[model samples]
Target: MKKIIFSLLVLAASFSANAQVDRSTMPKAGPAPEINLSKPQSFELKNGLKVIVVENHKLPRVAYTLTLDNPPIQEGDKTGAATLSGALLGKGSTSISKDAYNEEVDFMGARINFGSQYAAASGLTQYSDRILELLADAAINPNFTEEEFNKEKALLIDNLKTNEKSVSAAASTASRALLYGKDHPKGEFETPAGLENVTLADAKAFYNKAFIPNNAYLVVVGDVDFKNIKKIVTSNFKDWKKGSALPAAFTTPKNVVSTEIDFIDMPNAVQSEVIVENLVSLKMSDPDYFPVLMANQILGGGGEGRLFLNLREDKGYTYGAYSSIGNDKYGMTSFSASASVRNMVTDSSVVAFLEEIDRIRETPVSEKDLKNAKAKYVGSFVRSLEQPATVARFALNIETENLPEDFYQNYLSKINAVTIADVQRVAKKYFLSDNSRIVIAGKGSEVLSNLENVSFKGKTIPVKFYDKEGNAVEKPKYEVALPEGVTKQTVLNNYLEAIGGKDKVAALESLLMVGEGSVQGTPLKLTMKKTNKEQFVQMIEVMGNVMSKQVLNGDTAVITAQGQTVTPTPEQLKDLKAESAIVAELNMLDDETIKLEKIEKVDGKNAYVLALNEKKKAFYDTESGLKIKEETTQEMQGQTFVQTVLFGDYKEVKGVQFPTKLSQSMGPQNIEFTFSEVKVNEGVTEADFK
Candidate 1:
């Protein structure tokens, strides 16, 4: 009873003390907190491999990163040799079988991977010794067999092919290739031709010459003693011989004299990829580093940045906008602000980007912007210090970038010291908007005319054309005249004739299609069923779990997703009922609103574009008379999205031709579904619509 009375008295006194303090006055910002960061221990081996170790006992695990800090490799025709060679490593060593090596690593729940010039391994502290030994064996004595080389080469080429039609990929390559000439190491990109030229001999030669111990650093972090790690590293790498000195210098790339637009025409692009880039020479040790970092943060760092607010939030041109500046110790790097925007606003987005860049350069950032940016950096730095690997990385960076001993130690203080003046100064020095290369990769038919006359502040920017491979080319002839005497009804009749006869199509009672594809690496299956009775069912599954289901029966339409069922409005149900036919074109043929808009290219083939009302369009091949593509405009959350579907690989089933391949694009995602089964008048019943 006495203790309870004492506790109540203390609580009452705390409340009385709080009531006496002033609550109206705002508090001043405090100084940067002093970070109790632990420094990593370092040692050098006789073979010139430097090791840095950071001990953290909080987690009974360890990680080692072997980075070859060498100059960028300029591979002419064999541009992908280093990447392929890196992938070839860690498959198996001369000492262990491939299956055995992978099985053991998996059993230990560890990850071991290698790249062109780096290797990483992590496991529990108890298995650290074996992990390091396996890593060393794989790195030093890689099994470079012909079969493995073929597999890796094919995989690399496959990746290149996959990105062949990607607008963003084309923009990225064109930007770097223009910033730094294609001959420079920083500008070189992998091509299928390059990968095909890369023989096993080239990979072996690159590995022998580039993977040297002289310029490599092995960073070890997590639970381990410095001395024990040093001993084990020494014993494992002592026998590895050091090669000749690596290349240390290269020519720095220069920026353009004035801002200009470089446009690449891709007829299939649904949106435009805009990139404004300029070459700048900056390094980690430079005094302007911290200020440039802050400037980028305030300019286009994240969703809060000015570019995002203007382009996405205000103008509604894109999903997001961002900017980044690269710092390189070897050669000059680039500063780029970029976005993927609707094709109609490609030119407008470019101008908005330039305005933001110029605004940051001309005006001094407000004190609030400065404080917020600093707070973000300070918070991020303090949180990163909690990770033991951060300590090891800091040590390695200091050694590699020639930074001072206490560079990361005073990181937060330096960030906090940056004033608005510093941000404006760096902004003017680095953000070279006047001498920028505006790269726009998109459909020439849609955006070319607008981009040709794009003006910022009454000064029109000249537009230059280039092919997707970065080669200068003449302005493409986008207009292909429609053939003589072709009307909407003729096109519709041709499509009906292309896919089975009208009589056969009308006689069909039911149809079912089963297709398989993946979205972001998740297995997706689509099952669609339709009956002549105007009942339709569509189901989408991810990994065999139904993600969404939609059913249209008679005049009612319902959609089920995430345990919620929603009924479509009368207008939406009318549109859904129009698609209840087995072949939609059969109904479209009777609609008077459908008209032939024009003839445009769809995947390099001339196709007839039919405007199916204001919200949808369909493209039909002029020669084959088959419906090749469909486009629809949808509104969700006050934002508009254009979804596209490309149909190809037609095969005959039940005496009617059906599309076997379907590629769909919704916003930023593209899924290619390959049909495995097509049943006509079978595999579907009235109960399926339930």
Candidate 2:
């Protein structure tokens, strides 16, 4: 009881002391804290390898890093030379077999990877000496032969094939090409031809010319003695050839004269990839570096960024969106904000994206925003300091970037001193609203019209179209007139003849197709059945779990998905009925609205376009008469999405031709369905339709 009474008395005294102070006045922050950063021990070998060692005994692990400060070079036809050189590295040495080398590394539980301009190894300090020796042996005496080159070349070719259809991949390559001209190193891409042009001799020559130690820096950090590391590094790198790599000269990147929209048409893209970027001359040594970084953090750093809050939280147009500002020493730097959004909102998203940038440039951020950005930087810097590798990296950066030795020492104070005015100043300087390129790769038919009229602050946005190779192309013609001697029946009859004889296609009564494939990386099995009487059923299973089912048994049509059932709209019902027939193209013959629209190029092939209905356009290969593409619009959840269906791999099944491979795109997702089982006439029945 006495202790409780004493506590109450102390609480009353504290309240009295607090009440005596002013409540409205803000409390002043304490003086900046002192920083005691560790400095790395540095030494240079006669071979020109500069080694930096930082010792910390807190952990039993050590990391050794070798950075080649080679300037970015345009590879021309040999774009994969550096990449091949890196792949050839660590394959094996004269004294060590590849198998034995891998086994020994695994035995010691060490991780090492070699890149074009960098290599690193991290493992327990107990094996530090062996790891260093192994790294040195592989770095100097690499074994490159035809066997590994062939294997690596095949893998690279496969990657290029896969990238051909990926929307994000196309956007990345195209963005670089659009921002920096194709002649620049940043714009070069590795193609199959380029990779094939690389020989083993070429790889070796690249390694010899670029891996010289003159501009190389090795950082050693962790539970190792500085003196021992210096000796080990000298012993390992002493025999390395004493040569200097000549720096590469690159064509400087230039910004646009005015803000413009650059578009690349990707037929299979479900979502549009948008990148609003500008070229700048930023470096770590510039006074605007910290402020620009802080301003970018406020604009689109992460989940808490303004881009996310506005584009995702407010409009729900995308999953995530972000922006970044980067700096480089040898070449021009860039600032960009990128996001992939549903096609319907591509224009709106672009507008909102520009609006955020404009807001930052024209409007100064609030006091709270400035404080939060500073806190974020300060926190990230402090957390990074906990890692020994960060210390080694800081040392290397100071040398390579020509920064003051004490730049990192006052990191916190510099961040805290940044006022709201600094953030606005850098934002305006770097985020060039009037001279930026809005580079986008998407379905041109769906988003192009909307972009042509997009305006920001009452100024109409200018649009430019470019091919995947960054070549300027004429605007795609939207409304082409039907040519003479081409009628609706001419295209239809040609398609029938290309697939099968007209008599054979007309003889088809019932069809059943069992296709197995993937949608967005998920396994999907599609079972579709149709009869001559318009009795149709379609079901989809994702990994054997039925995801959706649609049925039309000559009467009511209903669909089930996500544990809910609903009757499709009248338009959907009409579409289903048109497709319910065993041969969907036959319905076009009977419908009065169907007409020959025009002839256009679909995937570089001359295709005759037919308006099947108010919302569907079918493209048929003019030469082969096979249906090549289907363009349709869908209304889902109060939003309209344009979908494109591609057909290929036609095969004969019981005297009828059917597409064995199918792909469909719907708002940023690709769905590929390949038929494993197909039947005609006898396999489908009323029971199957139910």
Candidate 3:
């Protein structure tokens, strides 16, 4: 009996193995089962509320969405008022406190969400039939209370602070600002200041003006009877009042005539963020919309896009980069790229980004590239419908954009019909290198000078500072006031002597200086090398590793661990030159005026704080008694670090004595460092740089 069972099992396994065959060689299978799509029914209530219902009995759940099209037509600074009002609505309602509403929703397994766009505001709720009445109550009778409004406002402000620290968020905001002028309704970006100005009065006024039933559309989808849904909506919204029709809020802006470069300086940045944008087709109905979308895909839309292939795979300047167009009532298109290259190669990287854009416009995409792009797009699109939310969103887009009912059904056909000529034409038309607005956010002094030397167009480019709202704000100009009894010449010459004697410092073969410090309680170490070239290695043992290198004779700047290297942008190059100048000035300081103050135990190690004072302060007499303090400390990584250096300590290294000892307390551990040998005037040679 056992032998017979074993033989039967082996036979079963063999049969199963043979059943799997090569799908490509097999006969074509029949089409999949047809989807039972819900047909949407529409009606208008007595109070002018437009209702749309799509009945789906596949599951015991329902989803409701309400939208209001009352964007601010007469704009002052009321940009995000509608959005804020929608957000505050869910905090509480007339009959229920916020806590009560939250608890009820949680117990019933339901969700409610609300938001606003430039021309519309929307709310969404999902729950079973048993809790449908509660959802209706929250929607129809929102409290819009003063306390709730203030609390929501504070939350919005806090969220803005968190977003400002993200590079991607900042880039997106900056790109939109350039696409639409700061004042334009379509382009208005949120800022901490704008959010702060929003009050209970603003929320109330906005709600009253925009949230009327007449100006809104309610969409419901789920396992509910059409008649019952209609009856429920009518009874709940009967008391709602009609409102005046709102005028369209967004207007298309004229395309910029020339390319402009904007810079946002993030001091002590290890990488430079770059974005290039310009106007493109705004209307989904525009003849160029499809072509432009397909063109961007071929250029820099994803992993296989032109930018990723050249910058990441070929030259290795960035970990990744991409570009796309924002298709809305107003069109704004842009190509953005980023790299954390050495401070020296910032210019080279910018050149490469520009070159890729130019190539896409000048050269028509190859047949293979076009085919691959279409295949990827179509495959991705088909896969997206696998999720119900995506399918619903696709259907909603057709309704919102006023697109043809057959749009999704014909999507693949449209993508397949795009020709090589279409790609080339759109690229040439939209990729305007001269008119592109270039924005660079990085350490300004380390990247700007070199950028200026490179001629883009016929003239030198000017760098402009932008506020969080994307407004061009003038930077505050101020002169540094020196302490009393300091002369300009004494400060300049004596500071140089402190680093090392002028000749000895100039003849030094190479210098390696390690710096450690704390930023917001996070310990950080910066390894700096000065030879024929310059480089900085930033290590935060707790956080990880980051490195940047710039070679004097080469145009390339490299960020090793990230696998990125490229020429610096024109702006980046300019900053690098300025940084070199400051370093050069410090190398010329005198010794006697600059001396180590004393050695003291800091964080369990012998550490020294060097002090430097200028011998003559006449030429540099913007201030007197100019002093620099340098603190040194040691770490367990077998590294001696200069922790906190005060440039204001005027006597140690003449005018700049960097702290040689320091420790930063983080959590339960303290990151400490101590510098071992302090040598000035060692002949730092060119070979050391490489």
TM-score per prediction, in order, is 0.95, 0.83, 0.63
For 342-415, candidate 1 gives per-residue lDDT tens digits of: 88888899999999999999999998888888777777788888777677788789999999988887788889
Name the best candidate (by TM-score).
1
Model 2 lDDT-worst window of ten: 633-642
- Per-residue error for 424 in candidate 1, Å, reads 0.6
Question: What digit string (tens of lDDT, one per residue) describes model 2 on residues 371-443?
Answer: 8887787888889989887898898999899999888887778778877889889988999888899989887
Best by lDDT: 1
Where in model 3 is the C-alpha error above 4 Å? 1-38, 69-75, 117-127, 130-132, 161-174, 194-196, 249-251, 330-343, 456-690
Tell me how far the alpha carbon of residue 584 in candidate 3 is from the true structure, in angstroms, after superposition.
26
For 201-235, candidate 3 gives per-residue lDDT tens digits of 87677767667777677777667688888888777
Order of candidates by TM-score, top first?
1, 2, 3
